[model samples]
Target: MRVMAFDYGTKRIGVAVTDPLQIIATGLDTVHPNQIIDFLKRYMQTEQIERFVVGEPKQMDNTPSQSAIHVKGFVNLLKKTFPDVPIEMLDERFTSKMASATIAQSGMGKKARQSKALVDNISAVILLQGWMSKP
Candidate 1:
């Protein structure tokens, strides 16, 4: 079953999708918050997504981050809109930091690495990879 991952934010949402075999996670695209549901609806017409993995941001002490409130609200709408697709929340404490570092180490250059959209895309990839790694 193919699974999709999303790194949600107030301004932008990063997206990633697993291969059909569910072995590799690839960065898909970044969309504005307002366009996310429509984007997903179009994506659903083309791909058979079985589940959704949403990055659940948390503070260092394991408390929900301030931005998590928005994520929770989005989750509610997601459930109501796509009731057939199961959604799972995955801890996303350091995924952004890790994604930035990964981009920096990849020789992507300072300007590209500084792009929030790229960071979001990489964050989604990281989140999906983490989910795939779990036994």
Candidate 2:
């Protein structure tokens, strides 16, 4: 079974998946919030996903941010949609900044670096990477 991660947004949700051995994570795609279930259903036809790592926005003081309410609703919907699959909530602060730094280091051109889709995808990858690194 493979592990998956999602960088959720109001408009789009960036997705990333780790190989069965849980070694490397690759950015998969960005999907609309409403289409996520269908997308996952199609993906599961070939791959068995064991768990989902979802980014939870939080304030600097460790309090849930306003966006956390939206995330909670999304989490509830995700749970209802995939009852057998467990979900993990991760504090996502500065993931976007980290992703941007990573992209800059990759030597991508300015246009590519400014692409929101690419940033979201990389952010999802960073989220999964953070998840796997936890002890």
lDDT of 2 by residue, 1-135 (tens): 899999999988889999999999999999989999999999999999999999999999999988898889989998999999999999999998999999999999999999888888999999999999999
Please list the residue runs of candidate 1 whose C-alpha ends up more than 4 Å from where it truly belongs after superposition.
none
Judge candidate 2 against the unseen true structure and give its global Cα lDDT, from 0 to 1. Answer: 0.94
lDDT of 1 by residue, 1-135 (tens): 789999999999999999999999999999999999999999899889999999998988999999999999889989999999999999988899999999999998889989999999999999999999999
Candidate 2 regions exceeding 4 Å error are none
Pairs of residues clashing in candidate 1: none
Give model 2's TM-score versus the native structure.
0.97
Per-model lDDT: 0.95, 0.94
Which candidate number maximizes lDDT?
1
List the candidates' TM-scores in order: 0.97, 0.97
Question: Each model's number of backbone clashes?
Answer: 0, 0
